[model samples]
Target: MVARRRHRLIQRRKMLGFSQEQLAHQIGVERSTVVRWESGEREPRPWQRPRLADVLEVSLEEVDELLAAQVNEEPEAERLDFAMRNPAAVDLVTVAHLAQRVQQLNAQYDAAPSASLLADAGHCHSQVTLLRGFAPNGRIRRELCVSTAESAILMGQLVWDASQRRDHAVSVQYFDQAISAAREIRDPILEAHAQLRKGFVALYGTKTPKEGLRLCNETAIVGRAGSNVLSGLGFLHVGEAYAMLGERHDCERALGAAEESFARIHNDDEALHMFSPTQFDRLAGSCYLFLGVNDKAEQILTRSARSLVRWKKSQSIVLSNLTLAYIRQGKLEEACGTLHEAIDLIAETRGGGGLNTAFTAGREMSPWRHEPWVQEISDRLFALMTT
Candidate 1:
C-alpha cells in the first residue's frame, strides 16, 4: 500500500546526463510531473510516454517496463553499498549506478557552491577508485575506469574551486588521476579535458602564462583525435595565454582557429555538450582586456554576459572583467554597479576565478578608492570571501 520509486527510470535519466528539470523540459512537462513519475505516485500520460521514452533513450516497451517495476526507496544506494563491501562482484549495472550518481552530482554542480559539492564528489571518486582496483579485467573494469576518469575530473574541479584556487597541488593530483585513466582507456576527449583543467591552475592560480600555453597546445593536439569542442575550447585558452603574453597576432590567430574548429561541430560530435556559444566571446573579451583595448573588451564582455546569465560562475567572471573595462574607461559609477552585480553572483557561486577577478577589479579602482561606494563594495567582497 506504499508508494515506490522508479529506480531504473531515474538511473536511466541520470546515466544519460539529464537532470529531472532537463528531462521535463525535453518531454514538455513540468519538473514536478517528472518527480511524481519517478516517485511512482503518477504515471506519464499516454500522449507523453513516447516523448518521455525518447528523452530517456529507451524503447516504448522498455519505458512501460521501467514504469511498472516498483522499487525500494533507495535501490541504487543499497547496490552501491553492497558493491563497496564486495567490490569483486561489481557488474555493469553497479557501474551504471555509480556513474549515474556521479552525473547527478555534476548536474547540481554549476549552480551550487563548490564547497557544498566537494564532499559528495570526493565520495563518488573514492568509490570509483576502489572499484577500479578490484574490478576484473573486462568490460566492467573498463566502464569502471571511465567512471573513475569522470569522477576524478569532477573532484579536481571541486577541490580547486572550493579552495578558491589556492590549493593547486591537491587539485592537480586529481586531474592527473583522470588523465591516467583516460590514457588507459585511450580516450582523447577525456584526456584533453583533464589536461585543460590542469592548465587552468597554471594560467590563473600560478600566473604562468607560458606553462599554460604549453598545456593549451598539447591539449589542442590531443583533442584533434576526437572532440572539436575540447579543441575549440583549448584554442580559446591558447588565445588567452597569448594575450597574457602580449602576443596580439597569435591571440587573433588562435581565435580564428577556434572559430573554425567550432564550425565543424556536428549534432553528434563526441563532446558537443561542452560547447558553449558564449565561450569565444568571453575569452575574446579577456584577450582584449589583456591587450589594453578597453572599449573592445567592454563591448564583447557585455554581449557575452547577456548570454551567460544561466551559468553563474562564468557570468560572474564576465561581469568582473566588464567592471575592469568600465574602470579603465574612467567610468567610476558604472564600474561600481557592475562590480556589485559580479560580487552578488560570486557570493552565490563562490567561483574561484570570479572571486579573484572581483578583488582585482576592486584593487584597480584605486583612483576612486577614496569614494564611500568603492570602500563599501570592497568590504562586501571581503565578507563574501571570508564566508
Candidate 2:
C-alpha cells in the first residue's frame, strides 16, 4: 500500500518538475521516506492524510472523491480519525502542510513578479524565513537539490553585490559557499568557476595575487576538459599572479599556455561568451607589458583596447591594463587618456570594485612610480580610493 501511494506521489511531483526532496519538504516527510515510498518500500499511514492532502492541494473530500471516482473504494474512515486524534501526528501533519504551502507559494512567486524584476529578491526573502523556521543542524538544514550551476549563478550575483558595497568579507563568504556547493555536486566546471571567482576576490579585494594564483591553478586543472574558456581564463589569472610575484619564467609560461588554449578553442561552445580571443591576446599583452616587454605589450594592448569597446563589461580591467602598457611605452599622454576612459567606465558601471582595479593599475605602474606622469595618475586614483 505504501508503494502504491509513493508511486502516485512521485508521478504527481514529476508532473510539477519538483525533486523528491522538494516534495518531502512540502509534505513534511523525511526525504528518505519519500524515496522509500517512491521505491514501493513503505507507505504513509492514515494519520498522514491531512498533510498529504494539503501538500497535493486537495481537500480530504476531494481526495476521497478522486479515490472513489477512480476505484469505487473508500479508506477506512475510523483509522484516519484515530490517527488524526494523536497530538504528535496532528502537529507533524500541520507542520508538513505549512511547509508545503510555503514551498508552493515560493514557486508561484518565483515564476512571476511579486513586485520586483529580480525573481531572486523574492526567493531570497522567502528563503530567509524558511531557513529561520528549520531546526538548527536538522535534516532540513539548507535547501537540498540546489545544483552546482544554480549555486554558481547565485554566487556570481552575490559577488556583484559585494563589489558594489565594497564588502570583501561578504564576497569571500559567498565564494566559499559556492565552492562548497560545487564540490558537493561533483561538477568540475562549476568547481573551476568557483575557484576563478575566489581568485578574483583575492586579486581585487585583498591584493593577494599569490593566493589568487593558487586558486587559479586549481581552476585550470578542473576546467581543462569542462570548458576551454575558463581553462584559458585560469591560465591568464596565473600569468597575472606570476607577474605580480616577479617570476618572469612562470609568467611567460602561463601566458603561453593561455595563448595556446585560446587558439585551440572552437566556435561552438557557449562558455566562451564571457571572454574572447581578443581579450586573451590583450591579457597576454598586458602581462608582457608589465614584464617590461614594451613593444610586444603595445601590439597586444592596442588590439585589446580596440576589441574591448564592444565588450563593455571587460573594459574596466582591459583599459586599466592597456594604460599600463602605454606607460611602459613612454606614451604618458595616451596612458592618461586611457586612464580617464577606464575611470569613467568603472564609475559608470560600478560593476568591478573601483578601488580594487585602481590598486592593481597602481601596482602595475610601480615601475614608473617616481615619474611625474605616473605619479599624476596615481595621485588622482589615490584620492578616489580614500573617498
Candidate 3:
C-alpha cells in the first residue's frame, strides 16, 4: 500500500511536469528515491507523505484519496469506472493512466453481462465525441477533452477488439453506434478520425483499400481547412491511400501537400494540442519512408525522433519509422536496436495498437523481408501480428 502511494506520488509529479531529479530536489530526497517510488520498488516513509504531496502541488487529502482509490484496482472494470467518474481529476495523469483506463474499459466490455455496461459505454462514447470536437482549440481544451474522448475511444476500441475476437456482428453494430454519436457531436475532425479508423477496418482487416480510401478521402475533405494539424492528418490518410494503391506520384503529391499545410501551422510552442511540430515531422517522415526516399525520410524522421522523445508520447511509432530508415541505410545493428526499442515502448504505452501502427510498420517493412537482418525483424514482428 505504501509502495502504491509512492507510485501515485511519482505519477502526480510527472503530470505536473516535474523531472525525477527536480522532484527529489524539491522534496529534499535523493533522485534514486524518486526513481524507486516510480518503479514501485520502495515506499516513501510515512513522514515523507506530506512533503511529497506538497511538492506535487496536490493536497495531501487528494493524494490520499487517489492512492486509496487506485491502489487496489486490479480488474480493468473498476479502473474504467473510476476514470469515468474522475475524468477532470486525471488531466495531469500520464499516458500510463490513459492506457490503464482504456484497458479496463476494454476488459469490462468484453466480459459484460449487463446492459448497464453498454449504457456506460455509450455515455463514454458520447464524452469522446464531445472531447474530439474540443481538440482543435488549444492544449488546455485538448487536455480537458481527452479524458472524455478517451472514454469514448476505448469503447470504440473494444468494439474493434471484439471484431478481432470474431464477434463480428457486435463489433460492426458498435462502430455504427460510435459513428452516429460522432456525427451528432458535429465535429468534423473527429468525424474524419472515425472515418480514418473505418478506412483501416476496410483495408487491412476486410482487405479493401479501395473502400478504405473512399472513407479516408471523405475524412480529408471534411478535415481540411478545419485545423492545420487536422488538415495534415487528413492529407496523411490520402497519402496512405495512394501508397496502398501503388500510385507513387499521387502519394508524393499528397505527402507534399501535408508537409506544406504542416509548415504553415508550425510554431515554436505547441499551438493548442491540435498542432505539434513533432507530429507533423513524424507524419512527413512516414510518408517519405513509404515513398522509398530514404534520405528525405531519414532527415524528417530524425527531427521527429528528437521531438517525440521530448514529448514522451508516440515514441513507438517514431522508433518504428526510425528502424525502417536504418534498415534502408543497411545499418542492420541500428535497425535491430531501434526495432527492439520500439517494441518495448509500444508494450509500455499499450494504447496505440488500435491505430494499427505496428501492423503498418510491418507492412512497410515488407520490401526488406528478404534481407537477412530485415527478415529477422520481420519474422518476429509478423508473429506478433498473427497472435
Cα lDDT of candidate 1 equals 0.88
| Full-model lDDT for every candidate | 0.88, 0.60, 0.59
Question: In what order do the candidates fall by lDDT, top score first?
Answer: 1, 2, 3
Per-residue C-alpha lDDT of model 1 across residues 1-387, encoded as one tens digit per residue: 677888778767776677899888889989999999999889899999989878776689989877885544446678788899999988655787998878788778779999999888888899999999998887678778888988999998888898989999999999999999999989999899999998898899889999999998888899989988999989999999999999999999999999999999887677887888999999999999999999999999999999998899999999999999999999888899999999999888898889999989988987777889989997998798779
Ten-residue region with minimum lDDT total, candidate 3: 109-118
Clashes in model 2: which pairs?
Answer: 2-43
Candidate 2 accuracy as lDDT: 0.60
The residue-by-residue lDDT of candidate 2 on 268-325, one tens digit each, is 4435555565767766776776677877877787777777665553666677777767
Name the weakest run of 10 consecutive residues (lDDT summed) in model 1: 68-77
Q: Which candidate is the best by lDDT?
A: 1
lDDT of 3 at 1: 44
Candidate 1 positional error at 113, Å? 0.8
Which candidate, 1 or 3, would have the higher TM-score against the true structure?
A: 1
Write model 3 residue lDDT over 222-249, tens digit each, in one string: 7663556666766776776677677778
Kindly indicate the candidate among 2 and 3 with the higher TM-score. Answer: 2
Quickly count the clashes in candidate 1: 0
Off by over 4 Å in 1: 1-14, 18-74
TM-score of each: 0.85, 0.56, 0.51
